[model samples]
Target: MAPLENLASGRGAFAPSSGEPASPSDGSGQSVGSGSSGRKRVPLGNSSAGGGSTSGNPAGDVGLGGSSGQPGNPDDPFILPQENASTLDKKLKVEVPMEIVVSCGPNGVVLHPGGYRISPGALKGKGAILAKELRSIVRLRQQVDPMIRPRPSIEFLVEPGGFDTYHEARRQTVISGLDWPVSLQVADTKVLDFFPGGRF
Candidate 1:
């Protein structure tokens, strides 16, 4: 039979009172730590000698084998693990220069440089024209293109209070139609002022 101290601390298997193996608990019918089963509850930190325990592997315990070797408090749920700065930088870096710009407002969808307007009604059918025009302008293939020099930086500005229900759909349509990199932003007058000619 296992010692009384071992049984109380849940260190050893349940000991039987008679020659037959004992059921989980004493005849009182109450389980350890309010468990329906008659087994005693083991502490979170301890592991059995053979590496078996009621709780899972001790390595994953709150603080022991976390990113840092410090012990984590099991009570605190909001703790955020530290992340590697270099990994974050690599994930956030932009790989390609933006080459498509779109400005959407209540007035209409306006293509930059030439300020071509596509009315809301015509947006469904004529939207592809904007992408085609931008491609031509970026490639410097247009006969009367204002941007004679091709620049790789392209940005899209969607004005606030514009294209209420159709905004996202129209924006995605323009994005999917373009072959080059594109950036989208929701800008007010103040942000637009930062553009070269105070136009976004």
Candidate 2:
């Protein structure tokens, strides 16, 4: 998705970024993660039922489509969606670190390291998004973008502000004013390791 420049008016929402081709689903309701694709799809279902497992191996044999149970990274940091089988839209809550940059982007506030977007209007007052570690709930819509994979849309539970930080595009340069418009480009790309090595 695109990034934002103006925080108050919500202006400068850049064009949605080009998406990567996602692996085709075989109607099994089992979303699998590929080895090279930097993307992982955790199938949505009720964990209590005979549906798939939420953690460990998502493609377990008891799920909608019975398979050999493909293995997934045990150390994966993401908390896959579960407990809701009614819709393709799901929410994944994550705690964002101050080290990762933030800006007004898709959803509302976009976090770096992963281009995770927050729900619109979730953030309260904001000078710069990277003031501290934030608890955010990310909305993930699987069916929205057919051409590309789904990215996390976040909604912060706490407000971020009252801290001085550098501009979005100009690294090491402090923002003249707290209310100045911040762009996604102002994010420090050098420190963040995004998909494909950089460029989120």
Candidate 3:
């Protein structure tokens, strides 16, 4: 008879035998290494059930692929569209009144009511000189005038035939002197002609 230790060693105690098959079912009907027949295995944490993709395309996942509208053009749209020269003139033109006053004395010119003054030597042309005088008058009024209303639009009260020498070009140059959006009119103390004949 073998010693107890020899007998245990010969029978391979504490080691599993390779000849016996692993149990396919241990109370749970599924196999230890694979699923049962006719059953499909699914991976954990799939996103398909929520109607989205794992690729992370927000628009594509919602079935909106290529449906997003194009971006707006950065160029200004308010600019007037191009047209024939005649049409362009009609669309883009502005009118401002021309009023003239004459002071030939050594004391120079004084814009009455507003009291803004300019020198006789400063009179280069009827339009240019008068525009400068008007601008100065506007500045002084903005500073000292007590009226709380909007600054009054300028109107030229020319003496009779005072601006007869001013051609269209000279008139335009004078009109450019005032800030934009100003209303202007010209009159001879009785008859008035609003500039630009038509609405802007």
Candidate 4:
């Protein structure tokens, strides 16, 4: 168990439901702060020798292990504990893999420039046409060109905070594109960040 997990028992570090957590001292020689970043962390040896209390690791999610998503709060999609994204999204019925790369204007889905031959700044065009296409792309996330093997990202400007209802999220999708099916807008994002449980 790493130092970041929040023990439901409130004793201390919790073993991630997933697997191992990340350790800050791996290279930096800087120890991970314990007890919610305020209290002192007992040395790993001492804690284990005494059969340890729970509040041992304080690195949070990272200490839990590899990032498996797990966003800061409910509004975000970081819930899972594994990073096998494509497969994970399918299990969650999320439709696609997307995240907020930038929380400001022009922050659209990033077509990861790998294996695929598509060009950036080119997928971009002038005015509403571009926005419309992007909006359309979002709508058709369930269906993608199988030939375009590269994984794609889908980003939606969440309601300043979060979607109040399923209907609201759907309605916002429509309204965001009111000007051109993909109008750019500002979204207030909550990025609290819990450590990934590793298997998400």
Candidate 2 clashing pairs? 117-153, 117-154, 118-154, 119-154, 168-186, 168-187, 169-186
Q: Order the candidates by TM-score, highest first.
A: 1, 3, 4, 2
- Winner on lDDT between 1 and 2 is 1
Q: Write the per-residue lDDT of candidate 4 for residues 109-150, one digit (tens) a residue.
A: 332111122122433333433334444454454355432222
Q: Tell me the deviation in Å of residue 135 in model 1.
A: 2.4
Candidate rank order under lDDT: 1, 3, 2, 4
Q: Write the per-residue lDDT of candidate 1 for residues 1-200, one digit (tens) a residue.
A: 78997567445455445554434445364534546664566665455545433354554434434534566675567666567997665555544343555677776677666676766666655446555556665555323443343445456677875543135334544465544444658755444444467432
lDDT score for candidate 1 against the true structure: 0.54
Query: TM-scores, in order shown?
Result: 0.33, 0.16, 0.32, 0.17
Clashing residue pairs found in predicted model 3: none
Q: Which candidate comes out best when scored by lDDT?
A: 1
Per-residue lDDT tens digits for candidate 3, residues 1-200, read: 44686434343222257754443443344334444553466655444565545554334345324223443333547444557997665445443333333322334444555555555445544657666655565556545633322243443334444343222223543566655343323434222342445431
Give the worst 10-residue stretch by lDDT in candidate 4: 111-120
Q: What lDDT would each prediction earn against the true structure?
A: 0.54, 0.36, 0.43, 0.36
Best by TM-score: 1
